[model samples]
Target: MNTCFSSYRSLFPVLGDYVHLASCSQGAIAQPISKAIEEYHASLLSVGTNWEESILKVEATRKKFAEFINAEPDEIAIVASASDAISAVATTLSYHHTKNRISLTDLEFPTAGHIWFAQKHHGADVSFIRSQNGMLPLEQYEKEVTECTLLTFISHVSYHNGFTQNLKKISNIVHHKGSLLFVDAYQSSGQVPIDVREMNIDMLCTGTRKYMLGIPGVAFLYIKKELAEQLQPRHTGWFGQEDKAKFDIYNSIYAYGAKRFETGTPCFISIYAAYEALKLLLNVGVEHIHSYLQDLGKFTREFGIANGLKVATPTASSMYSGMTPFFIDEASKVEKKLKEKRILVSSRKDVIRIAPHFYNTKEELEYAINELVQLVK
Candidate 1:
């Protein structure tokens, strides 16, 4: 057991008996997250409302998340979901003229396609770089992302097969063609280390439900400071104004930085949960979490292959995230059987996804894999 992470396992009581390998779909709940929820409920029950304190919590969470990604606090925006973050940036883009192409790939979660494809109504030209055998080729970006491409949206890690992209290389490709890079880090954040400045990401969005160890209803967005100042989001609301407390509706001046992307009041309870979760992740350190998860990922793939399961995740360690998915018929059925045995996993299509976090032990993974193999056979 890694002594550094082993101590943290006590914080997540679920690990005592159950084997949770579903960090791709949802992270196992921790005690801190539970306490955060209780604190929110207590405030509400006692004071009737906790708007002022909750807002401060939101700012703290925003700053923590910014630190998590090595971005400026001003560059971060607190939104309801990754979809909402994409919408704010997507809607503000000018898709009428020469630079109207939105480049994406097949590996993206459906939400990425749904959001960008919807931009066609605004005269946006959306092109897709099809994945070859569950992996996208770097040359595909060179071919598809042309000079006219405005933004090339990519998921840092694929939700289907755990295929992770090379952000720095792709950023170079997109920037060489004078196109902006928009990364959806929902599947990568908390499990992988991301530095917006080092990666040269024009925009990025990630939610805390998965590897961040928090509930849904809150997400963070990072936009380059210069890029954020260039345009105003069409999806702005009262909270997005320069002075949300001013209540001056006549002249609408958007808030400076990525805060302009925010809409109405945030999900306060979820924000409270996110604050503690972010603090926990930061304290543990993303670099350490990534290294531990990679070792687990390798263990999963090797064990599955040796057991005759057709693993769908990339064989290369660098090209994959924490998720190790193996092809199986009736995957959802197998997932249920595993759940009945107190081993939790997630299934998408014909593959059962086994994603582990830093808190997971190799023995737990072996047990989950052995059980899954038997169920599939």
Candidate 2:
């Protein structure tokens, strides 16, 4: 066990009760996050919904998430979910004759494809790059993404098989063709170290419900300042305006930078929880979390393979995210059985996802795997 990382497990009381390895679906709630929720409730009862304090928390959380991704606070928009963020960006695109193409792949989490495809009515020509043999090659992007390609959607890590992508390499390919890149980092944000500037990302979105250790209502969207300034989102509201307080019915003036993408009042309670949750990640450091997960992911793959289980995650450790899935018969049923045994996991289609965090111990993983082997056999 990595004592330095595993010691933080004490902060999550659920870990002491259950072998919680479902960070890919919903992270185990930490004590600080619980306390933060309590504080929100208490404030609601006392102050009776203070907008001033809520707005402060919203900005604070936004700033923390920006720091997490090495982006400016002005570049980050605190939206409802990754879906909402992606949709807001989608509406801003022109999709005219010149740059009418939108490139995507099969690995995206349905949300990207659904949102982008809907733009077909607006003169958008959407195309998909095939992920040959469960891997998305850079050459595929080079071949499919032409000068007419307006935007290319890339999942930082595949939710199905934990196949991580090289953002820097992909970004280079997208830029060479004069197109924009939008990354869905929901699977990789907290567990993987991401520097948007270093990777030359044009836009990105991630939700807090999974590895971010926060709740479902809040998500962060990062758009480069230069790009954000040019976009005018039609799917916007009062909050997206320069002055959320001023009720100007005649004007549609958007807020400066990424804030322009925000719509209506955000979920303040989730903002409170997200603020504390990001603090925990920043305190521990994402680079260290990535390093620890690398070894843990390797263990999970090897152990599953050794136990006669078909590990479906990517072979290389570097490509592994926080989750390691296995191709099992009746995966959803197996997930229920694991739950009956006080072991939690996630199931999607034919695979059972084993998602761990920095606090998960080696013994816990071994025990879970051992129990999983018994159930499947």
Candidate 3:
């Protein structure tokens, strides 16, 4: 157990009940989130449907999210979900002529890939790059992304197999070919540090759920300042108006920057919880969290493999994110066995994915790994 996160464990009541290693599927709720929801209900009762705080929460959460990613508040837009964020960006692209091609990998979560794939309806020549051993090689991206490519979508980390990619390397390739890079950080954001400027990313989106330590119904889309000014998404709604608070019912002019991507009303309750969770995460420091996860994940993969469980995460320990997928033949059986022991973990197809958060203990993971070995035997 890392003594560093031990003190903060009490903040997550989920820790009290189960050995939570399912954060990759759905993060265990923290104590602050429950308190935030109670406050939301109280405020709703007191204010009687007034939405001033709701509006403020949407913006404040966006700023906090931007701070976590090292982006400007103006560059971030609060979205309803990851799918909504990707679709908004997809709708903005002009899929007209030879430059209408979009490239994505087979490993990307469907939310990130499907929207662009559907762009075929709008005349986008979508290209799918194959992955080798659950990871995409930089050479494959360079080959498919050409001068005619309008955008290339890549996942910061694979949700299924826990394979992490080098966005900086991929970004340089896409840019050299005169195309923009859009990243789906849903699996990477809070678990790892993201600096859009450092990665030279054109746009990106991630939800509050999963590694972010928040519930569903809220997400963020980050657009580079220059791209936000030039792009206009067909997915715009009344909230995207130039002066939204002015309540101009007849106006069509969109707001400047990433706000132009925002649609209708937001789910403020979830945003409030997300903000508190991010505040705690920032205080803990993403780099420190990444380091800790690396240590734990390495131990998990090494021990699990040595004991005859096939591990599917990246070979490089740094490439291993918080999650490690143990590719067991009887993954479903193993998952059921773990739950019966009051140790919670998840399985995706034949893969039993183990994710340990900052609040989790080394003993919990060791127990889970040993249980998995015995189940397989």
Q: Write the per-residue lDDT of candidate 3 for residues 77-152, one digit (tens) a residue.
A: 8889989999999988898797998988888887766788788888999888888777787889878888889999
Q: Rank the candidates by lDDT, best first.
A: 1, 2, 3
Q: After superposition, how far is residue 61 of candidate 2 from its true place, in Å?
A: 0.9
Worst 10 residues of 3 by lDDT: 313-322
Clashing pairs in 3: none
Candidate number of the best lDDT: 1
Against the reference, the lDDT scores of all candidates come to: 0.91, 0.91, 0.86
Specify the poorest-scoring 10-residue window by lDDT in model 1: 313-322
In candidate 3 the C-alpha lDDT for residue 13 amounts to: 82
Q: What TM-score does model 3 achieve against the real structure?
A: 0.96
- The per-candidate count of clashes, in order, stands at 0, 0, 0
Question: What are the runs in model 2 whose C-alpha is more than 4 Å off?
Answer: 316-318
What is the lDDT for 341 in model 3? Answer: 82
For model 1, residues 43-109, the per-residue Cα lDDT tens digits are 9999998988998998898899989999999999999999999988989999868999999999898
Error of 1 at 174 (Å): 0.4
